[model samples]
Target: MSHENAKQQDLARATTDERAPMSTNQGQPVGDDQNSLKAGGRGPTLLEDFLLREKLQHFDHERIPERVVHARGAAAHGFFEVYDDSLSEFTTAQVLTDPSLKTPVFVRFSTVAGSRGSADTARDVRGFAVKMYTPQGNWDLVGNNIPVFFIQDAIKFPDLIHAAKAEPHNEIPQAATAHDTFWDFISLTPEAMHMIMWVMSDRAIPRSYALMDGFGVHTFRLVNAEGVAHFVKYHWKPKHGAHSLVWDEALKLAGADPDFHRKDLWESIEAGNCPEWELAVQIFDEATAAQFDFDILDATKIVPEDLVPLRRVGRMVLDRNPDNFFAETEQVAFMTTNIVPGMDFTEDPLLQGRNFSYLDTQLSRLGSPNFSELPINRPLACVANHQRDAHMRHTINKGRVAYAPASLDGHDPAATGAADGFHSHAVALEGRKLRERSPSFADHYGQAKLFWNSQTAVERAHIAKALSFELSKVATREVRVRMLDHLQQINPVLAAQVGRALGETAGDSAAAVPPSAASDKADEIAIFASAVSPTSASGRLQSTRGLSLLDGSQPASAAGRKVAVLAAPGSDASQILSLRSALSCAGAQAMVVGPHLGPLTGEIAAMATFANSSSVLFDAVFVPGGAPGVQQLTEIGEARRFLDEAYRHGKPIGVLAEGRALLAATQLGTLSGLTATAASGSSGSPAATLEAQGVLIADGSDVATAVDRFVATLARHRFPDRPLAAQIAA
Candidate 1:
């Protein structure tokens, strides 16, 4: 049959009955779909069964190779809109300058160094890649949650990933860097010091994809209509502000729900609480960049926000989830080279390497040069080119003249000249073709120290504990000591804190020596010594304002927060309903967790059960008044444990009237503000009794005031200053 006849028949079948019969790939209807063709009931199958052969063959090749990094990901469909034409003077790109056009976008959030089956809560760098289908073309802003990367040069990427991945000998630990190989590489690569500070901090374990900031790690150039070029760095600031999960919470969530981040993103969008981020850029000129002590081309560094404040230009809202995971999220490709007309690349070695690597990766992973023809990847702009006839080609050419510059077709599909189309920025180049790194990229520990100095006391402690936990897993003593020496360079206090946990001392003579002790050991130690010694030219800001997660600049709002309302038989249904209603009004969610998934006392249905829920999953916990319900909850071990865990994690806790009995049953009774006897004053107003420890108690009558105070406390996220030493295991 001719191709046209096959196409017509397929279209005719599409207009048939609603419940059509299943057909083969070739449109042949299958009658015996339940079983493969066989000679007899217990006989051997024959090779002549084309139906069985075709089905089995296709099933055998269902999966494509996963990415080497960022193998696990979740994606959503979205639109990006420029706030105004403010960026027009800097860039001629329509997507960045046109306020009326809502450019369609598909964004994929992923976990780096993890396989497709890895847990989402792993303490790893998160990939935040956005592919925008603009009128000009498809522009992919591939980046990560962390602003700075581990390595400055792209050639070291493979080595970095290989070391970070599970050890090849046993592959015992999956999706984790708390191992010997990773630390060994990091300890040797002094350039990773700054990134190590970030990965060890709470930033690595983000509370949710929507709560973390995204960054275009490498600096690029923005070219205007007048042919002026400026250095630019992109940032995606979450509208709700960046937040992170505690280490204990992250560890528990990894086992409780491997898809925690993915589920949160999907549900948030579905509930109409769409995730939004403001697109900001730090624009600078070549002269301004030259003044910075650190090299602007270094991927391992960041231009302090104070040095060059960000300019908010637009916003991106992910309002829709993908229809299919594999078709859109898994197969979608993002290349660093994908930029619009007004964008151009820099000579940053890491950025330069990514430009070549990303395209090659797509070719290898997608198994075809025509992968761009995939519906998820195809740009909205009209495509006109002489290139054709690759594997899986979708477009058909009309004229016989497929080649360019042919008079027979009037030189059709010609390239647009510089003024009308994409043009490279005019950058003069002068450099030798020798393998060398820029000296300006040195002083690796200065910014690392700056990060250490910027963090709050609690944040610094958390960083120390995280580093201790990771290094404790490294069985090799030399690697641990070497890492300690590097940490000492960042901060003596930080080094001492981690060293105490490791039962070793930082700056010891043994640790100062190179671990390998090669013939060039003296030279290696000298290099480390020189790299760590801070100089006036290190560009080290004593303290960066936004480096800490607890910075006062974060928006304190209860929106999108989740509170678990504990309920039992004979619980105060009115108070429960009132609290839920108030929390909903505040843009928060209140899920009633009971012993069983059914109506409890007063016909109040439970949305979650104690057995299926844990306090680590919630931002706060609340208990309502009722003698029988309070007594019942006091007796239930999980109920008591839930309250205990919530208190131990520094989450907000609220109790009213008889509900204090349940609080007394847990170890939280020993805490200063959360004691059962603390509410004896009989104050009806929750605000009057609000504790700095994040505990609220009041008489059951003032449900409105109680919810208001609770929501306000919950907005603070956590009271880390609470005495955790008094906490007991739940």
Candidate 2:
């Protein structure tokens, strides 16, 4: 049977309802689920109570050993469809080249260093692992949010992970790399500088999983029917555009809502606002690659778009949230070696190491080589393997002939020719057994500087602040100085700003009063500085497309954004309804937040209460006009705090006629005074003086006009550099 039919059959067998009658593991109906069978309902449980025994046994083994890395993650079920058959020219992989095929896929997004209980908003690399049950077989495109990795070779992966994780001696910090040990490792590894710039930038703190880009960090080979091979790098460009949260917002979210990213994904999918990304490929040949200054096999570099542009080939849309978190999301396994016929691995050391590591990890954590038999990990294609299962073996082999090419079974399961089966690309290989890295992978600072130069001014500022904050957390002064020395090689201005923030100089060991100690410190800095060449291909390219989240080409749609509409008992009924409807029409969720829950006025009800909600939860705020409502809102301390906090965070606020009084009364308004208002007309009518200041104001009589302006302003997201925003109290 075809993979599509297999997928349909699997979906049909999956449980659709959780309200079914309760039963034991053996499907025996249970009469009592609240209490276990006991001697007299208050005595020790009877040994004959199979239901109690089964339940307790299952509960005892419910928790599996979590993954060493990427322990915390959110997953979804989706389908991938190619845009056209143009990709077929490069590879024969049906999933990437067949426009008519709807390949079922499961994607998991995760943080690299965090444990199972870490905060979702922590600054770290995000894992973007996609498992596609293709027609031929399963293909797992395991990748991360960043295009480059910290190290060039996979041999250092353990060391890198060890240093980034909690200190082994004390296990002091969890899910963060700000401590001294992490810096100590990073300061010594010059190859880590390129990736360090990324982890310390805003990209580490994404606004939502839906808004970040995903990359296949290593270059792989795409083989066509003609046996021609091309080097390819895979990219997943978010359809909504790559965006990230402000540093302050990310920090607050970690404390206020630890599951912020996971919740955002689940709620958006449930609400029918599915997230999407376009699959793009940068395909090049050996000749083209030879002209590049850096090696394609290096994991610490990226092939800039300016050199080889990305070709948009397909799109993946995640429309369904997982039915069961543990059964589906947690149990699903992704292996780098699970590739189809037309795709083959490159000689990239990191890639080769991952090809082995991922499978080993699954075997260790899933507790069996038969992990592939699990429903979530099972392939949609038919299985005809001769090998039998080990632990957790669910499959029952009917025939006695387990071995292949048996005369007794008429050699029925004989292998097919190369053309009819999966084949690795035939490439000439030459190398002696060695433990040294290639010279081409030596230049690390070039790409580090390139990433720094590609960011917008505000983005660069955030990067500097992040570096300062992380380094400041390191108790060791030498670690901070060493990191600064590397940063100086990447960007002197950035290094200077971070050094000033830390109140220390890059190469100055003034605190080391002893001459010999200071000389030793200076020598270490010089060694790090000499390791990486500053002028390379990546640096010469200047800036590239798709690096900055605030670029002008990014989408300005308000779809999927959450807006908080603050209302009170006396809020204008028409104004409230009109604003909510307008926001809904824009595909944004406008939730009514009031002093209390339930009914607020005629035909108006509150969905969230001030005591239980904060402005940080929403993207923007809208206050409807009414004399009594404005008075009530101003009297509530939470309401004032919400407005003030929102303003301080640079969120746009819209106030109508009487509602304008509430804004003027807040501490935020006092800093800049209530701005001027414009004459009201229709939605098209603008010229509101306060609109320039990111505050849309209108007379109570023109509620429709004001709401239109407000929704429009909300679509633009936060207005960061407005004059009023500048005056708000920090």
Candidate 3:
């Protein structure tokens, strides 16, 4: 079999027993599996009920230990293919340079702090771990959605997770980091300021797993066939561009639907809307690294895109959902040490520690050194090794010799020479074994300020509001004040905004602290104080590229977006059907929502109801024209709130003919995008009107024109600048 079919064949063999007759582990026929072996109906169960004991025992031990972090996850099966062989000059990794090969991959997306049962929409880091089954071996690129981390060294990883997790004394807040313990830790760790800015920004609450970017967070090395190495950073850019949920939508989604992200991924794949991302890398040599002021080894820092642009290497598409969640997604294991010959580890302290910790963690979680034997984790490459069996061992080695260099077996499994086997890059090193951090990692506020300065005005306001909201949850006043001091170092204006929200002034005695006390050292600041200036030392745009979500460089598409069409009894079925057909042709789903489930009209049926679904769940709202239906909708409270809430959240809304009555009945006064004219007196064909503010209105005859204009507005996602002075509470 070819490399592509090898793993599929193994999985087929393992799952062949599915849908067979029910049986015990020993393959005995199970006639009464549901009731178990029992005594008389009125009497106590017999002690000889072996079937009952077996079922209960298996059920009790079914669940393995969830991960210490990133326990909540969803996964898919996919394939990764390179765009061309352009990267071959920099690395001998065939996975990145082989355009003809489609390497099989399994990707798991997750939230960092949540447990197995936590909601998927928490404001936290998202894990984007990928395991590629290559011809040479499996390569696991375990990363997060954000480009940076809260701490620089892996030694402080435990402390970071402990502080971010729920408080231990009472376990008060479930998956949130807004409590006192988290802010207390963050207030003291000055080095975490850069990552803090990212976490508190809109990037923390992604709109969807398929709409966010992924980063490897640490620098590594790419070695070519000649043993030459170059420092590299890995990135995964979504094909449709990165987007995020507003804070209000994220909070409402947590209570309304905990599995929002997981459902979205599964449905998208089933609907033939596969999620795609381009695998890009930032490649540079040692000379380039030395020219930078900040340390590339620091995990909390980012190498700005303007400094080193990304080179698109390959593309990955997730087209298949898992068959069994436990057998595949939950049991899959990924380790950072699983690299091929072309890739080697850098001296990044955090990466070095992770290379050791990942392997150790699997030993405890999977309960065996034989986790590699599992079908999901198994590589397509042939296995010929001297290692013997352990717990859960699936392989049966032949012959009497289990040790290497054996004479009895005629040295059958000898090692390949360096030319064909894995080789680490040879780099000269001279350093004392000390516990001190490099001085290059000291200037943390420079990048924090860079991020704050890169945002658009609206994005900046959102970040300020997020910081105020998170800090307001902390009960300890000192922790909030200390954080304000650190923020003052990053940007005084930001500090003042958050302080005003907290009912304190930024430079007050309770919050003011010397610059030296706020940072590692007062002199360290002078090293990179000009880093965030409009122009860098290289005369490049220093703060704008690849930082903001609304940069307009990212492409927009209408695929996979959902729109809700409101309907009621005696609704205009023809208008609804025409609009639905137009949206369907544009690759968007149009769901008819009514006051209750079932038929809303003779030809139209409600797929969703106002009571079960909220405005926050859809990308936009549409109201069809029908005097009776519009009157009925005007009497419904949910129908009225639906329009009000959609307008308040800046979502696009479309109304037709009599449907304008329902839109007008809401408290949204003087809609900016309304374009109305008398249907009978209009001389020319009525055309849909769309303003910069995302709202559309049209007569009943212009369904096609209205849909085209409405989709264009939906592609823009939202209008954050819409005037909300007349907005009413939903």
Candidate 4:
């Protein structure tokens, strides 16, 4: 363990012993805590049992209303610092321009559709909301893992959420969108096709909150000191680079560790592997924006990186976990309108709706119009305003002057001029009072096709598999076919692949025709899909490498990875220690797992046992060699099964000397073309040999070389190229 983890362990142990006497809510000492006060020790309880009354009363109201969305979340405290003041040329936001000031930030990551108690590993949109307390004010860049949203207009948000959430009839499904209602709504909403592609991709199921990318979703305006405005989109590129769990791994993790992503984030920070993201902005002037085929203000579209490159301005590092989950993570409110003077909202319908919706929802959920007074939401800059108190108001506004423009207080707390205070961009507005979408927002499937074309072969396969799985769960055949029609509009190949999985005919558009029950919804879908010719899609860039997670831009490193070292009685302490040391040196975590906890002979401590840990919890597994250890592990069913399951999941495995016998015992060893480098006489470099098959084998020689090669193989995360049959049962 590292020094940071040691300190964390100490802190955890320190909290085990209660130091203070138990007391009531009023600090009154409690004489009896176990049993409620009763008459004659068995008779009816009396009203004088103040302790019981207080306990039950508090318990009754202990839980507050969870968020309407993003209820399940994890949060951390951090600081943001700029690389330079170059951003000043684009915007006057001090947080982006000042390199000397480290702005304090609280970031909350969440699953959008899940309740507060839902599993963290659910395949749902992950919310990436950041509240930065700059010198100017609190700026909240509320975003998500995917850049686009399902709906283009904020008015349709309620409908979108209603469809994505559990069906209202019985609420059978929880924290999942694979149901009739969701697909039914999705099929009718053509504007959502682009976002659907993203949701079905592996990005929806992130490996960890620290590894996924975040985007501000809506395009906004950044005003400079000269009163010039530029369209901007915020992006947070993870230093570890974007990565995700395979669908099978994700499914198993939801059961094995419901708090998997949350625990991963908290533990990574505790282990001193603070997650970092570079804050970049895609800035384009009015002329540049006009050059784009589609509207720049469309929330469901993305500006290809090839057209306008990202400007890296600053970086954020989350180094501290929240002291209290509810006090910090739950109560923290992120409003889209909470931007500083330099930043302003665009006319994107979804964004305009969100600006009002966020504040309105916070008022009801936080039980206060004064939620900003909460520590996590409070601005670092001094607040001076004429606004009065409401429920849960913490500040006692002194003096009688509560309104501005009054002579009594010399117009104190008065608004400043455009140079200092917020000034809306001077873009002229002239429009009739009508409910209509802009003609510019008509093309929807173009970007969806672009996203499809951008994916690597492996990613495309995953997306197809995901779509197949989700549609398979839709009980309504009409809903499934309707969705296939939309998918065909985006990519005919994708629709055909998914169609095959549903046991339906391929290449025939008639087969995708909605059933008679869905006829009523057809006209609505046609209105959106038929209005535009989708000509803009042809002019759009063919593909952008940035859109793919498997592209060469993503960094491949072992840092922050967790490895489980399978061990048992008479385990080779030397080999385990060397491998653990190597992993730690690469900034990864290594834990020894055995049949039981505590000493596994010598200095090697069994951090977790088979009974308590599962292979799903770790990124990789290593089996250390020892004659006795191998024999013991062979007898332990879970120990032997662990390797088999790990192999089936495509996780990298390392085996030494006698440990090879344990591997040979599993079905993995019997697979055709399986090669154990230690036993194979073919002369080749160890890196090439091990990496080719994601399996490293070694005898009792060259311990350092073997461990180094094993660690390298583990860094690759997964070897999809390995020739292993999918039909092989673990």
CA lDDT of 284 in candidate 1?
97
- Model 3 off-target regions past 4 Å? 1-17, 39-44, 412-418, 508-533, 536-541, 670-690
Residue pairs in collision within model 1: none
Count of residue pairs whose backbone atoms collide, per candidate:
0, 0, 0, 0
Best by lDDT: 1
**What is the lDDT of every predicted structure here?**
0.85, 0.82, 0.83, 0.83
Instruction: Output the lDDT of residue 201, model 4.
Output: 92
Per-residue CA lDDT of candidate 1, range 412-507, in tens? 456445465898988899988899898999979878887777776667777877998999999999999999999888876567657767889787
Q: How many clashing residue pairs, candidate 4? A: 0
Worst 10 residues of 2 by lDDT: 523-532
Question: For residues 19-99, what per-residue lDDT tens digits would candidate 4 score against the true structure?
Answer: 666678898776556577788867999899998999899899778889889999999999999999988988888888889
Clashing pairs in 2: none
Summing lDDT over every window of 10 consecutive residues in candidate 1, give the lowest-scoring window.
Answer: 525-534
When superposed on Cα atoms, how far off is each prediction in RMSD? 7.3, 8.3, 7.9, 7.6
**Structural similarity to truth (TM-score) of each candidate:** 0.91, 0.90, 0.91, 0.90
Question: In candidate 4, how many Å is residue 115 off?
Answer: 1.3
Off by over 4 Å in 1: 1-20, 412-418, 508-540, 671-690
State how far residue 415 of model 3 sits from its true place (Å): 5.0
